[model samples]
Target: MTAPLSEQQLAEIAAREAAASKGPWLEGARRGNVPTLYRPLTSGDGVSTYPSVLFELTSVYGGPGDMAFIAAAREDVPALLAEVERLAARVTELEAEHPSRFAATPAEVDVYLRSILAEDTYLRYQQAIGSEAVREAMDDATAYRNCDDNASKKQAWRSGIDDALGYVDPDGDVGPYPSNLLCSQHNGFGPCPGYPWCTPSQDDTEPGDPS
Candidate 1:
């Protein structure tokens, strides 16, 4: 029986999980772990605050905001793990009471885990949308949508920050937006260069570049 986690513990677990794994989504939540994302990209060089990982746990905090948002959005990890352990414990108790006919295999557990993971993902996404930065950006773009008949306007609010940041896609009018950081070609150490986050000004666009 694991006791409840303190706030610092929660934050630490969240940081460790975000840097490493998909948190409770992939891991059973019963296991708190680290950067599986770093493996394929490095010689076990360990996880830095890579570009992709920032967007994984939550898309809420970006652009000038620090890594704190990742910690806030990590609620899903513990929440998912609690649900998993509670369900598994119940299943075990039931099987114990009726061993002759009752059983819970790992695959069966996985089926339930998948459903729960989906639900948690959705819940976290909604929370990300409601986050302060995202909500504010959406509000900033709301007028554009209100004035235009374009369907893309409806989505403008979410991606409005890209416009504000002057990071328009190649098609400025309609965008999949552009990344804040580009993979630097001049990385000195020769490895992936940490995919370190950069500013709009630091982007690699040249005059001939489509973007």
Candidate 2:
């Protein structure tokens, strides 16, 4: 039997099909057409000769060609939506067997970071950061949304790494670069190229984790 579709395949197919349904509508809507509905009034009351309210209205409530395309789209959109829904359900089902999308709590991030810091090589650190959970902690702008200020953003990410190592390891040895350094205080510099301010604890062995 043919293999069941992968979650990746299902996600790609669902996205493409959904976009296809919108493509024709966008094409028809963007087609250049400026009829009397959009032109300067030759002679009329204020409503006709005034600002772009009429133009905006006509754009939304499109004229003849738009109505025809929309009528056809109305027929196809429901089926397209239904197919998209079905594919979404299938993707959901298949995805259930995969790893849960990781969202790292502070404690979990700490655990992951500390565990790796104890190791001579940060293999675990690199691997874990690539995980959706740690990525959210370290680098995801959407995940760390309040990081509007540059310093806070830098602190947010740097502190995660530091906190992980700052905690004493199982052997009671603090990580090579513990959080006691207050690396955040070192904000104004050419580059933080030393131990506390900048230390390459985690090195990526493969092509997945961010540099």
Candidate 3:
């Protein structure tokens, strides 16, 4: 005679399948883990508090105001990813068109680097948003989602953000890196820097000009 599978065992099996189906998404969750968003961006006293890997997971899987917001993000992630990818491609194309501009100065290069990195991270995060694992994690019991567990989810979440942040923190309170780049350059806002989650500041008037 054969034995039937228990509900717990069945749930575990389903979870495993979901995670494997979306490797990149799980990776993002693992990197973005944070205990909470109140953490600062510095390291020591009087300094900014650096973002923890756990925060990323909580931000994505964790609902808005203790509610589930993953479903809506799930719907939006594809479009967001597409937008970032297109932006990144445009950056590369523009760089090719104006090689001299990108090679102008260190500050300009820094700006370009930040912009590209931000775009790249945006794409990766969107990939995570579409991941079966994240969706599974969000759809899982509200209690389970809150539990710390292995911290893998959090780490994965940050990884996506870190992909484009360079030396910056993804969920840090310093504002989006792409926006910071714009502020450094144009000194205004309204531009996207061609990436998702990156809002321009009051300084971003002209597009990035390495020259």
Clash totals, every prediction: 2, 0, 44
TM-scores, each model vs. reference: 0.19, 0.26, 0.20
- Per-prediction RMSD in angstroms? 31.2, 18.0, 31.0
TM-score of model 2 relative to the true fold?
Answer: 0.26
lDDT of 2 by residue, 36-98 (tens): 223333235545544543233235445555444445565446655666777788788887766
Predicted structure 3, TM vs. truth = 0.20
Candidate 1, residue 49: Cα displacement in angstroms equals: 19
lDDT of 1 by residue, 29-130 (tens): 122332221112222455544545432332222222223434445675666588568778889998787664236543344344435654334333323433
lDDT score for residue 115 of model 3: 62
User: Sort by TM-score, best first: what order?
Assistant: 2, 3, 1
Error of 3 at 110 (Å): 26
Error of 3 at 170 (Å): 42
How well does model 3 score by local distance difference test?
0.43
